[model samples]
Target: MITAIVLIQTVADRLTEAAQEVADIDGVAEVYSCAGDVDLIAILRVTNHEDIADIVPGRINKVAGVLDTDTHIAFRSYSSQDTEATFSLGLE
Candidate 1:
């Protein structure tokens, strides 16, 4: 799977609505409203790179009140869950 992290900026008054709309889009896996340079963070998981173009500009950007989006394709993923699972293998 290809994962993309989208940093979204929305109209001040429509932040929540915009996030819901983006989350409803097909490829979006999760959406988080956060404090930082961007208003919302959307995680997208898809089968290929082309899907990023289709989901981001084609769907996400078109949601009402979405002002702008900055998307980054993930080259690798590292997490404590993965590490824990790796270390626990064969322990059962």
Candidate 2:
């Protein structure tokens, strides 16, 4: 799967509504309210890279309150559970 980390900038007054709308979009796996330069972070998982292109521009950008978006494509993923297992060594 292709994973995209989308950093969103939304109109300050419409942040919640914008986030809710983005979360409803297909292929968007998760949405988070964050503290930083970006207002929201959306995790998108799709079968093809082209899907990211379509989602970011065709849909997300068109959301009413969305001001801007920055997308990052992930080549690899690591989860804390995976790391914990690696350190366990199958020990009891």
lDDT of 1 by residue, 1-92 (tens): 99999999999999999999999999999999999899999999999899999999999999989989999999988989878887885755
Q: Could you tell me which residue pairs clash in candidate 2?
A: none
RMSD to the native, candidate 2?
Answer: 2.6
TM-score of 2: 0.87
lDDT of every model, 2 decimals: 0.94, 0.95
Tell me the lDDT of model 2 at 85: 82
lDDT of 2: 0.95
How many residue pairs in model 2 have overlapping backbones? 0
Candidate 1: where are CA atoms >4 Å away? 87-92
Give all TM-scores, in the order shown: 0.91, 0.87
Q: Write model 2 residue lDDT over 1-92, tens digit each, in one string.
A: 88999999999999999999999999999999999899999999999999999999999999999999999999886989868987897867
